[model samples]
Target chain A: MKSKKWLFFVILIITTPLLATTIEVCSDCQIKTIKAALSVAKPNDIIKVKKGVYKETNLIIDKSLTIIGENQPTIDGQLKGDIFKIKSDKVVIKGFNIINVGKDFANSNTAIRVQKSNNFEISYNRFENILFAVYIEKSSYGKIINNKIFGNAKTEINSGNGIHLWDSKHILITNNYIEKMRDGIYLEFASNCEVVNNFSTKNVRYGLHFMFSNDNSYLKNKFLSNGAGVAVMFSKRIKMMNNQFLKNWGTASYGLLLKEINDAEIKHNIFEENTIAINVEGSNRIDYENNNFTRNGWALKVRGACYNNVFKKNNFLYNSFDVSWNSKMNDNLFEHNYWSEYSGYDLDKNGVGDVPYRPVKLFSYIVNKTPETIILLRSLFINLVDFSEKVTPVFTPDFLIDNQPQMKPIL
Target chain B: MFKILKYSFYDLIRSRWSFIYLMFYFLLGVVLLFLNNNLSNAIVTLLNVVTVLVPLIGTIFGVMYYYDSKEFTELLLAQPIKRSNIFLGQYFGVAISLSISLIVGLGLPFIYYGLFISDKIFEFLTLIIVGTFLTFIFTAISFFIAISFENKIKGFGIAILVWLLLAVIYDGIFLISLIYFEQYPLDVFSLGAVMLNPIDLARTLMLLKLDISALLGYTGAVFKKFFGTNFGVILSYLILIFWTIIPILGIVWKSNKKDF
Candidate 1:
C-alpha cells in the first residue's frame, strides 16, 4: 500500500509539465498557419507567431490558447476574409498588424471576430484599411486593449466600422487609437462595457456610436475631429466622466449627442472647440457636473422634452451660445454652473454670483428663427442684439434662465 | 395576391428558425430594458437593439423567405395570377409579419415604459413606428436583392453586406467626407451629406421632434430653419416616406421587367 501511494505521487508530478506547452510559428516553419498551431495546442499553451507578413485567411481557435505575435507580425487578410475567429474562453490575440479584410456589404465582416468567447485579451494589435478591426459578437468578459485601427474610408456605401461589438457583455476597450472608420467604437446590444482612455479621431461618422447598450461606463477617452463626436442612444444608467471632446467641428458636428438616455452621470469632462458641446434630447434624471466647456459653438444645447436634469458646478467659458432651448420652459435645473458671460456682481465675495445669469442668448433665439442670421455671428449687430435681449428677454424662452451662475471661472 | 400574402404569413409563422430568432430577440430586448430601468437609457438601448437586429433580421429573413419559398413560388406561378401580384403580396406579407414581430420584441417595451412610467409616450411611439418602417424599407431592398441574384448564398451574402453598409458603413463614409472638406464651410455640406442616409434622416427627425436640433449647432440650425416648423417636420417625414416608397416601387418595376 505504501508503494502504491508513492507511485501515484510520482505519476502526478510527471504529467504536470506536459500540460503547459509552448509552440513557435514561423513563416517558413512546419506549422506556418496560426490555425494549424491552435489545432494541436493544449489548454494554457502559448503559441508564438514569429515576425513576417502572414497572408493567411480565416483562423479559428476553439481552445484556451494564448497566441502572441513577436516583433509586430502582420496578418494580412488580403481582402479575402476574417483574420482571427476566436470561439474559446481565456484567449489572447496580441501584437499583430491585421489588415485588408474583405468588404462585404451584406454582413459585418471583421478582422478579429470573437464569438461565444470569455476572458479574452485582444491587445497591442495594429489594424489598417479593414472593414471592422475588432468585432465581438455573442461574447462575454472580453478586454480589447491598446489596439490601433485606421481605415481610409471614402464613402458610406462600402466602408465598415473600426471596433464593432454586438451582443457582447462585460467588455473593456481601453487605451486604443482609432481613426478613419465609420465609427471608432460601436456598441450594439452590448452591456456592462467600459471604454476608457482611448483616442478616437477623424472618423467618417461618430467617434463612438452606441445604441441599445446599457449600464456602460465610458471614461477618460478623447474623441476628436469626427463627423459627430459621440452618440449615446437608447441607453440607461450610463456613466460618462473625465473625457475630452475636442475639435469635432462641422455643421452638424457635436461633442456629444445624448438621445433617449436616462439616469446618466456626465462629470468632469472637457468639451473644447466643438460645434456643440452637448446636444441633449429626451433624456431625464441626468446629473451634469464639474465639466469644462470652452470655445464651443454652443456649450449646452438643451432641446425640449428633457426633464429632471441637473447641471451643477460646471464651467462654461467663451462659448458662442451658452444654452439654446426650443420650448418656453423645461423641468431641467441649471444651477451653480460657472458662466464666463455672467455679468452679475458678487459683492459678498462668495464664489457664487449675486444675481442669476440667464445663459440663453438672444442671438441664439434669432438663429433659431432665421438660421441664415448665423452668418452674422461675431458681428457687432449680433452683439448688440444679444445685449438688448439680455436686458429685456423676449423671443427667447422666459423661464429658461440660469439661476446661480458663478462669479468667477470655475477653472 | 391574397394567397401569396396568406402563404408568406403562414410560412414565417410556421418556420421554427423565425420563431427561435423572435424568441431570442424578444428575450434580449426585454432583459435589456428591465436592466436599463431609466427611460432615456432604455430608449438608447432599444435604438441600439433595433439598429442591429432590425437590419440583420430584415436582410436574412427577406433573403431566406424568397429562397426557401422558391418551390412554392414556382408552384404559385403555375397558377393563373400575375407575377407582380404574387411578388407584391409576398413582399407586403413578409414586411408585415416581420414588423409585427419586431414591434412585439422591441416596440412593446417602449410602449410599456411610456404608458406606465413616462410622459414622452408619443415621442417614443413615433420612434418605434419609424424604426418599424425602416425595417420594412430594408426588407423591400432585400426582396430586390433576392430577385437580382441567382444563387441563394450570393443573394444572402449581398443582403448581409448591404445591411452592414446601411447600418454601420455609411456613417464612416460621412466622417471621411467631413474630414476631407474640413477647410470648407462644413455646415451646408453636413446638411446635404446626412440627407443621403435614411437612418440619419430618421435620427435627425427624432431629434427634431425632441426639439434637440439646435444641439447639432450650425447644421442643426440649418435643419431647423428648413424643417423645424410643422412644415419642416412634414418634409422630413415626406423624405422618409419617399425612401420607403421609392425602393419598393423600384423593386416592383424591376420585378415586372425581369423574367423570374
Candidate 2:
C-alpha cells in the first residue's frame, strides 16, 4: 500500500506539466483583452498575446501564469493608472513594450508592480514615460533582467525610481538600462540582492541608492553623469566591486557616498571626473582596495565620524585634491597607494618610497573651514602655504601618512 | 601708430629678454610633456604655470621695458609723432611679443605630441588665449602706470603693487569677504567680483574648462550658468576683450594729457 501511494505521488508530479494549457489573446480573438484572458487563467497556464496594441490599465494577475508576447506587443496604459499589479507567485512577464503609465504621486503609479510574491521573472520588456518602472515590494527570489526603463523625470519630488525594492531579499537585477528617473535603482530595507552589469545614467537624483539595507552587493555596474552617483547609506556588510563611476560632475555631486555604513568592501572600482569621488560620513570598518581615483576634485572627502577604514593599492591620478578632512584627527589608514603627485625618492631602490606622502593639503583644510577659499585654488599664495605646511605639519594631523607609497601605480 | 608699432615690435623681437621669455616657455613645455609623457596631464600642470607666471612676467617685463625705454620716449616726444601713438604702439609691441613667445613656446610641444589627433586641443587653445589676454591686459596697465609717474622708483613700485593686488591679494580679499558673509548668498557677488578683475576672470575661464567649477557648489551653479554655456563663454571672452580695451584706453587718455 505504501509503494502504491509513492508511485501515485511520482505520477502526479510528472503529469503536472502536461496539465498546463495555453490561452491566446488577439484583437480578433474571443478573448480580446489581457483582462479577459487573466479571468480564465488557472494556475500554471500560459497567456500568449499576439502583436497589437492593447489599451489596458489596472490589470491584476492573481494566478501562476506565463504571459508571453508573440512579437513584442504594446500595452498602452493611456495615462490612466497602474498597468499590471502582480500578486501571484511563480509568475513570468516578458517581451512587452509598456508605455504611458499614469503620473500619480499618491498611488506611486507603476508600469509593473510585484507584491508579496516569489520565484517571479520580469525580462525583455521596455518601459517609457512611466512614473515608476518596476516596483517590487515584499518579494523574494525574483529576477528582473534586460529591461530598458526610461522615464520623463525632471524633478526629484515629481519622479519615481526605475527599479524599486522594498523589504525584499535574494533578488537578482541584471543588465537593465535605466535613465531619467528619480533614481535608477533604489532599495529600502532590501537585503541579499545582487545588482550586476546594469547601466544607469542621467537620473534626476542618485543613480543607485540604498537606505537601511544590509548585505546587498552590486558588481560590474556603470553609473554615468547622474545628478549624484551611487549612495549606500545606513547599510552594513555590503560588497561593491568592478563598478565604473564616471563623469558625475556637479557642485555637490560625488561618485559614491557612504553614511553610517560598516564592514563594506569596495574593490576594483573606477571613479573618474567626479566632483568628489568618495564621500564618507560616519562610516566605519570599510576596506577600500584596488580602486582608481582619476581627475576628480576631491578624491575622498571624510566628513566626520569615520574610523578604521583602510585604503590600499589604489591609484590616485591627477585629482585637484587627493583627500580632504575637516578634522585634525584621523583613525583611517592609507597605505601602499600610488599618488601621481608623490615626489619622494626611494634611496633603497625598493618599490616603496623612503619618505612618507601626506595626501591632505593645508588648503583643503582651510577650504572646509571657509568654503570660499576654494576660489583660491591653484593660486600662488595657496601653493606657497601648502608647501610650507607640507614641510612642517601643523593644521593637518601629523600621523596621517602613507608610509609605503608605491613607486609605480598598481595595475 | 603702425610705424611706431613696427619700430618697437622689431626692436623687441631683436632683444635678449624676449628670447629668454620664449625659451622659458619652451623649456617648461618640453619638461612638462617629457616628464609625464601625457598630454592632458601636462595641460593641467601648465594651467597653474600659465595663470600665475604669465601675469607676473607680463607685469615685470612691461614696467622694466617702460623705464629702460624712457630716453627713447623723450627723444620721440621731441619728434612729430603723437604721444598716444607712441605709447599705444609700445604697449601693443610688448603685448604682442610676449603673446608670441607664449603661443610658440607652449604650442610646439603639444602639436609635436599629436595634439591635432588628440582631444585636448580645445583646452590647449583656451590656455593660449587666456595667456595672451593676460599679457595684453597687464602690459596695458603697466604702461598707464609708467606714463602717469615721472619717478622711476614709484612707477615700478606701483606697477608691482597693482600686479600683486590683481594676481594674488585680490583673491585673498575675495575669499575673506565670501567667508565673512557666509550667511548671505554670495554667487552673484562672487561672480561680479571675478568679472571686475581681469586675472580672476581669466582664471575662472580656465578653471571652468578644467571641471574645477564643480567644487564651487551653489556658487558654481550660478557660475555654470554664467560661464558654462556657449553664450556665457562668448560673453566672458567679450568681457576679457573689454578688459584689454579699457586699460589700453586708459593708457591713451593718460598719455594724451601728460606733460612728458
* Winner by lDDT: 2
Query: Candidate 2, DockQ to 2 decimals?
Result: 0.48
True contacts reproduced, candidate 2? 0.55
Candidate 2, after superposition: displacement of residue A233 in Å? 1.6
Model 2 lDDT per residue over A1-411, tens place: 999999999999999788879999999998999999999988899999999999999989988899998899999999998999999999999999999999889999999999999999999999998999999999999999999998879999999999999999999999999999999999999999999999999998999999999999999999999999999999999999999999999877999999999999999999999999999999999999999999999999999898899999999998999998866567899999999989899999989999999998888888777675676678766777789989888988776889999999999
The CA lDDT of each predicted structure is 0.80, 0.90
Worst 10 residues of 2 chain A by lDDT: A368-377
Error of 1 at A59 (Å): 0.9
lDDT (tens digit, per residue) of candidate 1 on A169-214 = 9999999999999898999999999999999999988999989999
The TM-score each candidate achieves on chain A is 0.94, 0.95
lDDT of 1: 0.80
Per-prediction backbone clash count? 30, 0
